[model samples]
Target: MTSFQFTKMHGLGNNYIYVNQMKEQLPEEELSEIAIRVSSVYTGIGSDGMILICPHCCTCEDAHFQQ
Candidate 1:
């Protein structure tokens, strides 16, 4: 079986699933279905939404300048 590493978090009382994109590649076509399936209250993992964790490509200097 295939496995994907993820994290789970919640805001207020609403729960969500977080996927680290640096490690998992979810195809564009599967995005909508992935969200729907994961968020389904009755059929799937049951979340209010899914959150993606991705790296920030810019340098620290750029971040400081943007601030």
Candidate 2:
């Protein structure tokens, strides 16, 4: 199992788990599971959802620059 790092934050009351995919490499298939795992209120990061913060890229094919 591959593990990544994340941070929890709120904006004007709404909370979300932030994942910086720019620095941490993760498999594409695992993104959905990561979001679910991180947003769990019982045994996880405990957030409303996940907000993946990735780098900006000109290529739409880039994982971080999903269209």
> What does candidate 1's lDDT look like per residue over 1-67, in tens digits?
2246667788789898888887567775776777777778876679877776666777664321110
**Pairs in steric clash, model 2:** none
Candidate 1, superposed: residue stretches over 4 Å from native: 1-3, 57-67
Tell me the TM-score of each prediction against the true structure. Answer: 0.67, 0.69
Per-residue lDDT tens digits of candidate 2, residues 1-67?
Answer: 5677778889887888777879776787987777777678775868878778767767566553331
Q: Clashing residue pairs, candidate 1?
A: none
Candidate 2 at residue 49, lDDT?
83
TM-score of 2: 0.69
lDDT of each: 0.69, 0.73
Number of the top lDDT candidate: 2
Question: What lDDT, from 0 to 1, does candidate 2 have?
Answer: 0.73
Error of 2 at 22 (Å): 1.3
